[model samples]
Target: MSKVTEVVAELVSPIVTDAGLELVDIEYVKEGRDWFLRVYIDKENGIDIEECGLISEKLSEKLDEIDPIPHNYFLEVSSPGAERPLKKDKDFERAIGKNVFIKTYEPIEGEKGFEGTLIEFNGEMIKVEVKIKTRKKIIEIPFEKVANARLAVTF
Candidate 1:
């Protein structure tokens, strides 16, 4: 996370938590002449458009008061949706028994990416049940090796 994103997260965390939402992720990126501050939020029952609008309004007011970003940027507040990224330990824990796609920072079992069911997450390691042709195999992945992970929407 960038310094700007860290500051923005700090500013938005309380607002999100007070609203009964979880802060999924924050991004500050420049596209052409525009800078965008995107905030991803979620709730146990899922998020709706109205919730997004509400958060945008509240965060906008707060950002106006703080003015952390020097340049003009679009502030977007919305749900992480079905394929939500597994960012924190809690995210991984909540994803147990769900189908997931994970990428490792370094190769594991000669592969960096794996798609399977997240059978377990016990803080230090994740045990995934992967299908190889007709058979199922369980692979244990250390937490430190995970580069990225998200719920996999399989058709």
Candidate 2:
């Protein structure tokens, strides 16, 4: 995460928690000629439009007060959606038994990415049941090796 994103996360976290939501992620990036600040929030049953609106309003006011960023940018607050990222320890723990897509920094079992059923996550490693043709294989991935992981919506 960048310094801007870190500051934004620190500023936005309390607002999200006070609003009874979890702070999923914070992103500050430029697209074309425009800069965008995206704040992702979530809840147990999922977040609603109204909830997002309220958070945007609150966060906007707070940002205006703090004046953290020098450049003018668009602020967006919303849910992470169906394929929410597995970022924190809680996220990984909650994702047990769900289908997930994981990208590793280095190859594991001759592969760098894995898409399978995440049957278990025991802090240090995750056990994924992957289907190879007609057979099922279980692979253990060390948590430290995972560069990115998210819930995968498979049809």
Candidate 3:
């Protein structure tokens, strides 16, 4: 996360929580000529357009007051979608029993990526059940080694 994202996350956390939503992630990035501040949010069943619009309105007002970002950016508030990235302990816990894709900072067990069923998360480690041809294997991944993790949709 960039400094701008960190600061924006701090500013939006309370607002998101108060609205009975979970703050999934925040991204501050430049795409082509435009800078975008994207805020991902979620709830139990799902999120709708109205919820997103409300969040955008509230966040826009707050951002206007604070004027944190020096550059003009588009503020987007929306759902994380099916392949939502898991960035927090709670996210990992919720992802148990679900299919996930995990990328490590370096190679783990001769591989840098794993896509499998997320069997467990113990705050320090994760156990994924991966299928190799006709055989099934369980891979233990240290939490610290995970560079990226997200829910995976298998077709």
Candidate 4:
């Protein structure tokens, strides 16, 4: 995360949590000539359009007051959608038994990525059940090595 994103996250988290929402992630990046500040939020039952609008309005007010970003940017508040990225320990824990896609910082068993059933997360480790042709294999991934993880949709 960039410094701007970190600051904006600190500023927006309280407001989102107060509204009974989980802060999924924050991204501040430049695309072409535009800078976008995207805030992803979610809840147990999921979020709706009205909730997103309310968050956008309230968060915009707060951001305007703080004036943290020096450059012109577009602020977007929305749900993380189906393939939500797992960035926190709680996210990993909640993802147990679900299908997931994970990319590690370094190769584990000659592979850098895996898509499989997230069998368990033991706080310090992540165990996934993957299939290779007709064989099923369990891969243990150290928690610290995961560069990215998200819920996966499989047919």
Candidate closest to the true structure, highest lDDT: 3
How many clashing pairs in candidate 1? Answer: 0
Cα misplacement distance, residue 2 of candidate 4 (Å): 1.9
Instruction: Assess the local accuracy of residue 64 in candidate 2 as a C-alpha lDDT between 0 and 100.
Output: 90
TM-score of each: 0.96, 0.96, 0.96, 0.96
> What is the per-residue lDDT of model 1 for residues 1-155, given as tens digits with 9 covering 90 to 100?
89999989998999999999999999899999899999999999999999899899999998999888888889999888899999898999999999999999999899999999999998999999999899999989999989999999999
After superposition, the stretches of candidate 1 with alpha carbons farther than 4 Å from their true spots are none
What digit string (tens of lDDT, one per residue) describes model 2 on residues 1-155? 99888888888889899989999988899999999999999999998999999999988898899888999899998889889999999999999999999999999999999999999998899899999999999999999999999999999
Name the weakest run of 10 consecutive residues (lDDT summed) in model 1.
Answer: 64-73
For model 4 the local lDDT of residue 97 reads 93
lDDT of 4 by residue, 39-75 (tens): 9999999999998898899889988999998889999
Candidate 3 CA-lDDT value = 0.94
> How would you encode candidate 3's per-residue C-alpha lDDT over 1-155 as one tens digit per residue?
78888888888898899999989999988999999999999999999999999888888888999899888889999999999999999999999999999999999889999999999999999999999999999999999999999999999
Those runs of model 4 whose alpha carbons end farther than 4 Å from true positions after fitting are none
Preferred candidate (TM-score higher): 1 or 4: 4
